[model samples]
Target: MPHRKLQPGRLVLASHNAGKLREVAALVAPHGMQVVSAGELGLPEPAETENSFLGNAGIKALAAARAAGLPALADDSGFSVAALGGDPGVRTADWAELPGGGRDYTMAMAKVAALAEPHANRRAWFTCALVLAWPDGHTEGFEGKVHGTWVHPPRGERGFGYDPMFVPEGHSQTFGEMDPAEKHRISHRARAFALLAAACLPGAG
Candidate 1:
């Protein structure tokens, strides 16, 4: 399919996560696109019934685009561990959902550590699936992954989610420790965003 040129307009970011919104907003900043969060618009978070990242991302993007009557961008991201057979993959976000309420990454990291304790292969990766959808139902998708290992006692406090426990293949610091600018440059989201820019904004990256 030919690349879809995204015209300048208000694009809804189909997410309530502050960190994701910030990173994605920066990635698309050069394209002159105005990014707004679903939360800002008071749009409801759609049920992510899909099993795959791309499918879930499309669900959110489509829901937001239709509700806001504007083009929308959404992403589904998670961590996969080789030892755990990529566990906490699609379940990454809810892995630490408290029994009563709330999500906790600290517990999530602890679970990962416990599961990976006996395994010699600590190889893992972060996966992100990006989707863009228009009000009319047109959509585009991109995927990106970054391989690395899991660390114990979770390090740093800069990034969110599994960042503190993930050490990218070539980096000394976990994603949680690295500067946001540096993380964005080599992040799974950044890789997907590059593809999105090439498709929708031509030469914008």
Candidate 2:
């Protein structure tokens, strides 16, 4: 099926995460789209019951699209350690959930570090799934990944989640240390957005 083209207009970002909202808003800015986050609109977050990145992204996007009656873009991304057998792939954010209803990424990062300490292989990767959904339930999805080594003690204070620990291949600086523009150039999310842009966004060809 031919992909539907999204015209420049108001688009909803189906996520409550500040970091994701910032990054995604930046990605869509050049395309002449006005971005509004689900949080800003007071849309409730949907449960991510899916087992894969794309699946979860679809859930979020569709929910927001239906609720807001507009096109919605959602991202589901995670950090996976090879030695851990991809233990926290889809449940990446869940790993940071606090008992009192909030997330603490510091604890989450510590858990990842401790679990992988016993293994010599520090190989890791970040995976991102991007989904665009229309109010009528139509959807498109894309996935991307970047592989690198997971470092200890974390690094820069710039990025959120596991960025401080992940060093993309061929680069010495962790995602947390690199400038936002640099990270956006080669990130897993950027790669996925490239695919979506080619397929749907105007002037992206």
Candidate 3:
């Protein structure tokens, strides 16, 4: 469906991360609206009490939209390990429950490695659930996931939060070893963002 004509003013991204702000900024900049994060406006970061990724995403988006008095987009995502019984799903961002905590990809990988009985059963995927809620009470949601297998001990210094251990479907290298553009093109977050852009961006990229 076509976007319900983007509202006429500033739109906020219901997030506190610089990375997320940057991504959402890029996604909505072309739509003629300024996209800023809750942090940028000195707004309080809301706690995510929702059980599921989509639930949490909607909660944030709706809260921010109400707070900013503008349409808002929020996303919640995680790396779920099959062998680990889908652990780290809702807690992906909450890893250590601190700022920059999710950047500890090594720690994340170690935990997953501990769970995998054998080397081959360590399969997993990154899932992203995004919600776009407008000030007018309108909303849109999309979820995307990229399948991959863990890289045992993890590798590389690039990316974060399990990137070093995640080898996308067919690629021989991990997300940490790949360039930003390459990862963005195939990442779960990227796919999720792409869906939002295509469905709600109008002319956004």
Candidate 4:
């Protein structure tokens, strides 16, 4: 069945990642709302100083909501290695000193691998925290995750960053090879957004 549209309004998508922006676009596309990102709005970027994903998501959402004087949506997500004691959990995007701040996805994954033990029992999960903030001070938050194991030799090129290594539970293919539609079906983020859309979209009764 097709998605129902939401009442048209200006909702802010507080994010810097282009992939995230695109994904959110598809989620809200049926809503018939004009969505804009912080980057697109030329708003001052705020630092994510909160202690957790939900905290960080709220910080971003509140900032955008205040700036846009409208409801705002924000998502913060990261991967966790069960063996690593859930490290790189909220710090999925670690910054190394360099031009554009070197992004070391390969090194990060490798580090996670090296940190493992006993045949590299690579159990891991991807987690996403989403927050929706309204100008009236109403806020909603949700979390979703896909449990899976890490692959020795990462495969595929269709996804960004860690997609090549994460094999969702009950499947051998990594997210990098899952394609857009495939990923949406079981994605942690999508599940969370589904709740958000259903509650706020038009004609939800």
Candidate 5:
């Protein structure tokens, strides 16, 4: 099926995460699209019950599109350590869940570091799935990934999530250590957005 082209207008970012909202908004800005987040629109976050990044992204995008009556873009991304047998692939957020509710990524990072301490292989990767959905339920999906080594004693305080521990291949600085603009240029989410832009955004092809 042919991908639907997005007009220069309001686009709903179907995510409640502040970090993700910032990154995605920046990516969409150059395309002349006004970005509004689901949280800003008072839309409740839907449970991500899917087992894969694309599935979860589609769920969020579809729900937001139908509710807001506008095209919605959703991203589901995760950090996976190879030594852990990809244990936290889809449940990356779950790993950060606090007992009393909400999430604490610091604790989550510690858990990951502790678990992988004994293993010599520090290989890990970040995966992102992006989905654009229309009110009528039509959607287009894309995925991107960046492989790197996972470091202990997380460094930097820039990018959110587990970025401080992930040093992308061919780079010494973790995503958290790099300037936001630089990280935006090489991140998994950025890569996925590149595909989406070429396919849907006007003047991008």
Candidate 6:
């Protein structure tokens, strides 16, 4: 299938996460697109029933495109620990699920550390699957990952999700400790967006 030419215009971002919205807005800003969050448009959040990041990203993107009748972009991202045999691959946010469905990364991070304490391998990686969907169902998916090691007593307070517990290889500070600009340069989401931009944005490649 020919890639859909994603010309600049209003695009619906299929997410309610403030951090994700901010990151995505920055990524697409140079393309001359007006980003509008699905939350702001009163679009209902869609359930992520898929078992993989790419599946979930497609689900969200398609849902938003159908709901808003506009092109949509979505991402499903999380951490996978090698010691746990990727036990939290798709359930990263729900592994130590919070009551009332809120995310508690601090508690989740502690749980991961405890589970990984006895293992010699503390290796882990973050994966992000990004999707862009058109109202007619033409969709594109891109994925990226950042390998790192898990740290106990999670450091920093800047980034969200499992940032505090992860220290990228060759980097001294945890992502949560790094400045946003610094983190963006090496993040999984940024990597995926780089590919997407090269393929979809004019003059970006």
Taking all chains together, each candidate's TM-score versus the true structure is 0.97, 0.98, 0.87, 0.88, 0.98, 0.97
What is the C-alpha lDDT profile of model 6 across 102-148, one tens digit per residue? 77888998888899889999899999999999999989999999999
Residue by residue across 14-103, what tens digits does model 5's lDDT show?
Answer: 999999999999899989899999999999999999999999999999999999999999999999999999858999999999999999
lDDT of 1 by residue, 80-176 (tens): 9999999999999999899998899999999999988899998999999999999999999999999999999999999999999999998999999
Flag the better candidate by lDDT, 3 or 5.
5
lDDT of 2 by residue, 1-205 (tens): 8999999999999999899999999999999999999998999989999899999999999999999999999999999999999867999998999999999888888999999999999999999999999999999999999999998888999989989989999999999999989999999999999999999997896
Task: Looking at model 1, report the run of 10 residues with the lowest lDDT sum.
Answer: 196-205
Candidate 4, superposed: residue stretches over 4 Å from native: 1-7, 95-102, 117-120
TM-score of 4: 0.88
lDDT of 4 by residue, 1-205 (tens): 4432335788889998888888887887777778888899887768989878899999898888888888888999888888778877888877212356767677766666767645455788998888888766667787888899887566888766677879999987898898779898898888778777776666442
Better of 3 and 6 by lDDT: 6
For candidate 6, give the lDDT of residue 154.
Answer: 89
> Model 4 — which ten-residue stretch has the worst lDDT?
95-104
Model 1 lDDT vs. the true structure? 0.92
Worst 10 residues of 2 by lDDT: 86-95
lDDT of 1 at 40: 96
How much lDDT does candidate 4 score?
0.79
Q: Flag the better candidate by TM-score, 1 or 2.
A: 2
Pairs of residues at least 3 apart in sequence or in different chains that clash in candidate 4 = 6-31
lDDT of 2 at 148: 95
